[model samples]
Target: MPRIVDRDLEALRETALRMGSLAEAIVAKSLRALATADPLLCKEVQEDDLEIDRLDVAIDAAVLELLATKAPVATDLRFVLATKSVATDLERVGDLARNIAKSAARLAAAPRIELPGKLDQLAGECTRLLRRALDCYADGDPERARRVLDQDDLIDASESRVIRDAIAEIAAHPELSSQEIDLILIAKNLERVADHATNIAEDVILIAEARNLKHREKLERAGDRRT
Candidate 1:
């Protein structure tokens, strides 16, 4: 029975990691759509979101089954719970990626306007954060997970600057307001993706160190040094 439970747990973890990879691909494709303004790629992102949703439901079911059957305790229990949390965050990341793709679709329709360079940089940074967070999970490395937490501040600062620049451009050219709105939304989605990545990294830390970092007052100071 113990051996069977161990195999089930391993399968659950693998499925969740596969789900993470899909979500990461969504982020990458969404960014590519924004850069290329390709309608087909944007449509692909929307389609892929459905698969991510299905994986989310499957992960939840697997975890609940483990809880009911295996009755995991202590560290094992924490691992299962943290896996659920990470899956939730990754689903949200998929949603954000779809939103970014939707905005890119809108941008494609509007008059051609060069997207901000900072927007490109922000997308790259946020993607890196997501990738590293997933790596931390696979390796169960809290130290590497902490490094992902450190990256959140940089993404936040980049997001702020992107928003500021978009606002300024809109003010200068009111006629291009539609494209500007899309640009702002894209930047917002990228920021939200970074946030989801941070959430996943925090969960990784919790699973590895057995320390619940959520709602800790001191850790709030970590966001102070933006970039």
Candidate 2:
């Protein structure tokens, strides 16, 4: 039974990795569509998101089954729980990618609007953070997961700058209000993508160290406020 459980857990990891890969590709394609304003690419991203959603459901069922039947304990239980958490984060990443693609499609019909370089930077940061988070999961490296947390602040700062620039653009040229709004939405989506990546990294930490780092972070924030 132990051997069978180990085999099943390996299979679960493989399935979860496949789901992660698909989610990453969707995010990459969504960014490309945003840069090019291609409606067809946007449609493709939406189609891929459906597959991601299906995988999320399948992974959740597998995790639950393993828990009920295998009765995983210690490290094995951590692996199961982490797989579930990562799947959820990946699914939400897919949703955010779809939202960005939809915004791209909406802007495709309008006059070409120049996207800020910072917007591109933010997108690149988001993709990099996500890839690193997945690497942490693959290697069970909490240090790498900690590094992923650091990258989130960079993306967040970029989002703020882009948002400010977008608002300014809208104020200067009211006729380009739609384009500016799309830029704002794109920045917001990219920020959300980074957030989900951070969640995956946190899950990796939880799996590796058996520490509730998120709760610790909340406590630290509370302490900061009191101080």
Q: Judged by lDDT against the true structure, how good is candidate 2?
A: 0.88
Clashing pairs in 1: none
- On residues 27-87, what C-alpha lDDT tens digit does candidate 1 reach at each position? 9999889889899999999999999999999999988888877788876787899999989
Positional deviation of residue 86's Cα in model 2 after best superposition, in angstroms: 0.7
Specify the highest-TM-score model's number: 2
lDDT of 2 at 84: 94
The ten-residue window of minimal lDDT in model 1 covers: 218-227
Residue runs of model 2 more than 4 Å from their true location after superposition: 1-4, 223-227
lDDT of each: 0.87, 0.88
Per-residue lDDT over 1-227 for candidate 2, one digit per residue giving the tens place of the 0 to 100 score: 33336688888888888888998999999989988888999999999999999999999999888877778888889889989988998999999999999889988988888889989988898898888888888888999899998887788899999999999999999999998999899999989988888888888888877876665667787784321
Q: What lDDT is reached at residue 54 by model 2?
A: 95
